[model samples]
Structure formats: C-alpha cells, structure tokens
Target: MGKYAQLVIGPAGCGKSTYCNHLYEHCQAIKRSVHVVNLDPAAEAFQYPVSLDIRDLVCLEDVMEELGLGPNGGLLYCMEYLEDNLHEWLGEELEGYGDEDYLVFDCPGQIELYNHLSVFRSFVDFLKNDGWSVCVVYCLDAHFVTDVAKFMAGALQALAAMVKLELPHVNILTKVDLMEDKNHLDEFLFPDPELLLHQLAASTGPRFRQLNRAMGGLLEEFSLVSFLPLDITDEDSIADILGQIDMAIQYGEDAEPRIRDELEDGGDDDDDDGGGDGGDDI
Candidate 1:
C-alpha cells in the first residue's frame, strides 16, 4: 500500500514554504497527523518540521563544491539525480509509512520542473505506482491580481501545469493578507471573460494581444482556471484551504463507523433475584 501525498508547486518567491508552514500549523490545530517532506535540494531553511528531506540524498552546496555547478545548474542536477534514482532515493525516504499516512511535499519553486520537464511527472508516477493518491497544489501570488496581463500569464502557466500533470489539482492565490486594497481583489477573483480579455489587451503591449486573446479564450471556454485565496496569517483561511485539499484526496472517508454497544432503558446484565431471597429458597 502507498501513502497519500500532495505536491505544493509554484514559481519562486510565491510563498510555497510559507504555505507549507501554515498548513503544518493548521493540521496540528485540527488534530490531523501530517508530515512535510522537503524536496528542494537548495532550500536554505524552513519553518516546518521535515519528515523526509531530500538534502539527505543531495544538497546543492555539496553538488556545487564537487561539480563546480552554479545554483540553478546545481538544482537541476540534483533533481535529475533524484529522477535517476527515484526508486532508491524516494523509496528509502518513504520506508516507514503505511498506506494511510498523509504527506505534504514542499517541492522546489522552479517552474520549469512542471512546465516542460518530465521530472515532476515522473515523480508523481512513481508515487502512484507505489499506491499513493496524489494531488497537485499550484500556487500563484495574489499580488499579481492587480495586473490583468500578469494574471493571464500566471493563469496560463498554471493551466499548463494542470494539463501536463493530469491529476487532482487545487490552484491557490497566496499572500492575500498583504494586499492593502482588497476591494480590487474581487474583480480578479471571479473574472468576467470578455472583460478580462479587454483588460488583458489594454494592459499588454501590441505584440502580446494575439497571445492574450488566445489565453483569455481558453480560460473562458474550459472554465479550467480559478484560485482559492490563501492568507497565511488567517487560521480560518488555512483551514478552509486544507479542507478543500482534503476533499480532493478523499481523506478519512474509508474509516469504519463508530457503533454504540451499551444496553439501554435501564437494563442490567445481572439481577440478584430480589436481594438473595433466602425465605423463598428455604
């Protein structure tokens, strides 16, 4: 049996780690056992407790020292190495867990991993083959909501990942707490198709109008893109987000129902025949 897992993915500085940390706390409050696995070989520090760490297998500093590769190159190399040894590295890391365990993987922020590369897909397949039900959590920065063109671009990138992974997914807009003027957030939250197209065309340069139109049409046609706002500071928001993901993975549905076995209506297993009944016995 394999474990249940979620891959938290997004571009750099989009608060993937922050989201993971917040999720860790949220799970704790709800009394749900969740383990976080750090998959970024170059991660410097993290706020959450890591159950399984890839740095044990490959660290960027060690790769750079031995192979003289730069940071980006080293990261790619580390991922490639993991891919080459998926069964060995990831298998060993996941040794102790039963099939019912839940894990949240804090993946690297490199967009290329999900965009055109097969590393992430391969990893997902490995987990599935091992019997895990996996979900992809793709995050975008809510700060980009103010810019129509940028939002379109980010949405398309997320869409591309959704199509490529072809798994259960949840799109999140992170850092909502940082927004000063959240009134404008509603426009981006539930976007109007035609209005979004017009705004995209106006904000972008002339060169991008055609691309923007195509993207806008795709989003409107399939209704494939929507984001749940995530404010790391708000516990309620975190709980809501976690609840959505939990539903996606179908967690806790397989447990046996609790049954009441106690006798009712003042029934007793033992009655002493009216307090010993010595006269009747004689």
Candidate 2:
C-alpha cells in the first residue's frame, strides 16, 4: 500500500542531480514510472522532469530577498518553510502523484543538513508517516580523495551520515569514469582497513598516528558503510547500483498479483458461447 522513494543526497559537486538524471533515464527505458521531487531550493537546472519542485513552494531567492538572508541562511529558511507546509502544499503535490509511484527526492548538498541538523530526519519521518518506504542514497565523488587521509575523511563523513539518517542507506562513489586510474579506487570500494592503515601510517603526523589507527580500526570494525562504484557511462554499472538500492528498499516486492479485466473474462466466455452470431446465421 506504500510507495517507494530514493532520497538522493551528497555534498556539493558530488553529482546528486546527475545521478538522479541517470536513474530517471534508466527507469524510463525499462517502462518504470519514477518521478522526481526536487528538494533543493537553490537548484539552478534539472535534466529530468520534476514531479514536485520545492522552489515553487519556497524559492531561495525569494527567501533571501524577503528576509535579507545570505544564500546558506536562505536555503535553510526555504527547507523550514517547506516543512511547515508539508501537510498543505507538499502533501497535495504528493497526492497528485498518488500511491504506488516510485519517487526520487533530489535533496540539497549541504553536509550540515544530514549530519548535525535534525531537519532531514524530520523530513524522512514525514515521508515514512505518509506511506513511503524511503531509502537514502548518499553519493561521493570518486576523484575527491587523492590520498589515504582524504579517503578516510570521506569515509567518516559517510559514516556520520549513515549514523545520523538511520535509514536503509546506500553509499555511492560517483564519476568513477572521471578517475585516471580506476584501480586506485578498489581499496575504498571494498574498504581494506589494513591497506588504508599502512597508507595512513606513511602520511599524517606522529602525534596523530594513534588517532589514525583508532579511526581506521573503528571504520574496519563496523563495516556498515561501503561504497558502490557508479559510472554513468556504463549501463551495467548503473543497473548494478540500482539493483542494490531496489533490493535494499524491497522495491516491487509488495505489489498485488495482477488480475485480468472483467471484460477480458467476459470476452472469453462469449467465445465459448458460440462462434457465429445467431442473427447472422438466421
């Protein structure tokens, strides 16, 4: 009875929208009805059609102008405004799409939103309350980290998000195609803590050696967060990532078995009744 949704999230320039675009195209190619809800108030452009745009409810420019707030402040204001109107404006928009429709909510890239703030948690609660089985897709750029320290930092950032949101989460390493040596990314994907520790030991200060070991050990011990490589150029890669998400949220697992139309059954009965019309024979 509930609909499925993917809450696409990441830091800025991590290709959240691009990921959504690719996913939209994939669903369309396969004849799946997946709609997008743009939750980013400051979004400039979109590659896919939007089912419900938060900008229409509260634009960032409008908030900045009306309240004399900066861009970051304005964005926060817009999200709060959206939350206030979820029952009235946003609820109506969701109802228009109706139930059983898979929706992808392209969320804002601000790290604070997912980590420190409770706003997104409230948003997720709202979706769950409204009969939506929601999954969070956290994306990170594969090329963002050039060294072990950076990789560790990115991993911890993702870990923080996973802990904060507490949803059926999937971490994505986007733009793998942009990487020079894709093999360099293997350690992060499967997350070999020993390899990372060796690299970390080489880098960082002596005072932080214990710190690095502790952090690396914590990450390896939990093993909850792992990245899935996503190269939008490759169809198989996209499908593999999407398949993981679909299984996570149990997509299409609850659908009722389809039944034939009454007319179809009646037509079959008529065929058995008699082939020729009685009037024609007469």
Candidate 1's residue-wise lDDT over 205-249, tens digit each?
Answer: 899878877777888887878889998778889888888887887
Question: Across residues 1-282, which tens digit of lDDT does each residue of candidate 2 receive?
Answer: 458999999888899999999999998998888998899999989999988888888899888999999999988888878778778887788776656788999999888888988788888888888888889999998876577787888888888988888889999999998888876777788788788888888887788988988998889888986899999989888899889998899886655333345655676678667763553454
* Residue 195 error, candidate 2, Å: 2.0
The number of clashing residue pairs in model 1 is 0
RMSD of 2: 6.0
Worst 10 residues of 1 by lDDT: 258-267
lDDT of 1 at 147: 86
Worst 10 residues of 2 by lDDT: 255-264
Model 2 gets an lDDT of 0.85
Model 2 spans > 4 angstroms off: 256-282
